[model samples]
Target: MIGQGCLEQDDLSSSINIMECPNVISINMSASTSPISVSWEEPTAMTTDGKRIAIFNQSHSPGTSFPVNSNTIVTYVFDDISVCSFNIVINVKQVISSPDACECEPNFTFLNCPLNITSDQPAFCGTVPVNWTEPTVIDGCGGSSSVEKTHEPGSEFPAGVTTVTYTFTDSFGNQSICEFDVIVPVVAVEDDSVPPVVSNCPAHIYEVLEPSQTSLIITWDPPTARDDSGLPVSLHQTHSPGDQFTAGGYELVQYTFTDAAGNEAVCEFAVTVYPNGVNIDTQPPTVPPTVYCPAVSYTPPIITVYVENEATSADYNFTWPTGATDNDGVTPTVIASHQEGIQSFPIGFHRTAIFYYDTSGNRKDCYQNILVRRQGSAPTPATVINCPQNVYLEIPEGTSTRVCWEEPVVTDDAGNPIAATLWQRRLHSGAEFFINGNCNEQFVGNTFYDYYGNVIRCGFSVTIRAIGHENLPGQWTQWYNRDRPGGNCDCDTTPSTACSNGEEPIDVQCETLAGDDWLTVGLIPSAPEKRGQVAYCCPRIGFYCWNRWNALYGQQCLDYRVRFKCPLQ
Candidate 1:
């Protein structure tokens, strides 16, 4: 076997060595109700032969440990070969644990903290109700029940701002506080009273011409009414003063005046109308003397005379002699001879009489003498011949035609050509146009127009007459019918040289002037059952140049198209 010294040299050198001391330990801890554990690194040493070794506390285990308030010593020993060993004294210390801080701040939620109330408790005539808001507190530690309020929440207070405080203590005994305010105000009331007054009420009377008059107008001074409250008072009328009333009697008219307060007053009057009486007349009239004169020429002279009734009443009618004048101012109820026109009279002392009658049927007569003597031989009469009979002609559409005839052959009883004033010719349809000539003369009728521009024909007539020495018109002739060709008479379809170029060919359509197409062309078909295109040429002269050509042609073509006749050339 080997000696003990030799065995130690082999094992001790590899297992043990002088150890190093651990660093002073320091610990910080929080004061908590639960248990806390602590730990550290063990001391270590190295052998002379380059081997590492561990050291452990001889008095304590390396597992669980507790912190202390003061510094404490722990001894650690390192053994090598069980004969050579060393101790490491570690100084472990503890820092006092700090109590937990209450980090939560107190907060209060006032439902309606800033509240308003009236001093009258219930303002607006008790229309407003009492009101307030409750206060709530919140804390971080969840101990809201520990909160205290200086005043009870939702409690009514006097009219003014009132401050309240809320305090909260958390589980850690940390305290916080919050404050809020409530407010109240004052208000006043309003009053309304008083009524209106009426004034200027008066009465009146009205009279009408006849009792048979049903519509009577009664006017008066309009009354005045006012309200004391400065408000406008409305004036109402059941019956207006100037309204209609019953006939043949007197009636009381009433007017009522009212104020805004429903107060009313009335005034009234009477309306009277008299009855109409029967009217009659029984008077005779006096007649003036008649002036006499000799028959001078074939033309009769005019005579004027006056008559009056002794009673000064114009209530009679009169009958005058032939060729005597009658005044337009004479009425059936009044008789008075004012003036007269005597167209013709015989060549002798002729007695003419005038009779008169009153409205009562009484009658009287007055007589006068007119001495008419022959002046000279009467002038000879005139004669006419060769007046136009009938004429027929064709005029272009929208054009006028002239009708002329050879002068008629005329002569007097002396076989000489009649003077220019002795003869006349007349053309008549619904009206008359006259041509005068004493000697041989020519006549032309007024220009006639075919306004419709149609191709139809129409007729008219003319006549001739002669004047006698007595200025009497005599020659009467039968109507002569003249035929006139209507519009289409001058229409030509061939295009003119000016119409060949320069302007593009517009699509030609056979349509009414109203733009209603009734014809067809190629793919573009018009309304059913119509004709082909109508060629129209626009006259671009003067005023016609500025006008739209299509519109002008359309209007003109409509008439012709409707008549189944093309107006375009």
Candidate 2:
């Protein structure tokens, strides 16, 4: 067992040097009514170099009696650092006495029984080998030297739930069995490598909206698809023909065709909508990379560049990104703080900020930093001023991809450039490549090299994450009407007063009575909703702001619009 990165092994002669406390213990009693007395010797913690380490948090003594029916977990700490845990189980023994003579004990138990396993079907799709640690069994009175099981470890299990049963039989043929389920999803088994082909995808288009109309209806011939498997394919679209397109520029329409085997292909087109009466050049032209942050959501990202040779400067080409399309046609103008070209960079720190503008005059900007380092310049360790912002991608788990990003920039005392070195992977870092999961803070070691080959070490933390499957959008339900203007606003909000709508005392059910979702009501910001007031307004969607004339001290009420955020469509 390992805690964080420290290993806790049980073997006395193990090569790991540091041996933890007792392993899992299972004691069986021969008599049914007698409780078993269990005992174990505490092991000494040792270092790899034949040194001794002090242990702390030693809660249990050398031995004790097992509880009648409850389970007892034992824990040990090594050097007040690593944690080790094991379970102690006592089996209830049932003696089968016979007139003929020797009889077998009917009690048979396993140590740390494996739990049910749930796993997605492997890419192989066929029967795959499923394995688990075969549990050790304890036999008290019967000499059960051998064991039998219906399905052994490493046995191939078909897709779906398969029960693996293990049986233990004693010398006198008394038997006991334990079973666990292994489930593999069946949908993923129907796999295909070939994606369907989409035809008649529309090209980019430009249009002028009618002077009187606020929007335009766009239409196109539906794209067709074919699968190499000669099977029908399902088509999903972001927008369909005759969908209303507002005056927003560069609206995207996409359709995806998926074959029966789960392979998919997409067809996409963009349409630029221009407002009324204009010259022949009214159609928007190809604009420069239109960035979408710094103004709206933009924060210039700091980029770090390392100079390889011990020189005053180095020549490096910058990488440009594909900016997002703007609602209004993007302007052709692109601004940069520093002139960009393949030029020599001096041994110092330099920053560049790029600004992008749309036709609407909304500005977005990004930032980059150039750090040129030389041998004789002062050496500085890496500092995380701005790490690369992470994004979610619709990529499958366990998939590997080559990723490149800007490294954070740092400077020395003289304000000269310095770059971090890829020193070493931590013991708990990713194996081979990063897997699909949420971002987590991981410590990384960095080593800096001076002109004389001396090393300067520094440690810092960074979050690493992977893109997950495509997320589905949430849908909201239309507001429901139960309460109206005549309803008692104060009584509705107050727990003591059963809200009366003048007709009868009935509290407004916030979806719970038919429940599942939370029902909300609108609130007029001007009028504060609070107690001590005669009647506060409780306005909600599908219902009007209501106030009971004499409800609660005659407090004034405000209007609000509330709706339910739907969990189900």
| Candidate No. with top lDDT | 2
Number of backbone clashes in candidate 2: 18
Q: Would you estimate the TM-scores of all the predictions?
A: 0.14, 0.25
Report residue 550 deviation for candidate 1 (angstroms).
99
Model 1 residue runs over 4 Å out of place are 1-196, 211-214, 248-250, 274-569
- Candidate 2 accuracy as TM-score: 0.25
Assess each prediction's global lDDT (C-alpha) against the native: 0.32, 0.46
Task: Please report how far candidate 2 places residue 273 from its true position, in Å.
Answer: 61
Model 2 agreement with the true structure over 1-569: per-residue lDDT tens digits: 21122245555425324454566666655544444577887655655665444343343456566543223445555543455555565555444567866654344445655545545444123466777888566666546446667787778865445666665666655444455667543233253445666779886556777889778888889788755333345555667678777775446576777755676687767666667874223333233333333333323224434567655456777544444345544543455655556766554444455654444333355555555555443444433332332222223445532232333334454556554332222321111123434222223333333332223433322323334311323333343444433344422232221222322211122322233222121222344342221221111212222243213224433333233222222
> For model 1, what is the error of residue 372's alpha carbon versus the real structure, in angstroms, after optimal superposition?
99
The ten-residue window of minimal lDDT in model 1 covers: 541-550
lDDT by residue for model 1 (26-69), tens: 44333332223445555555656664443311333444343322
lDDT of 1 at 551: 23
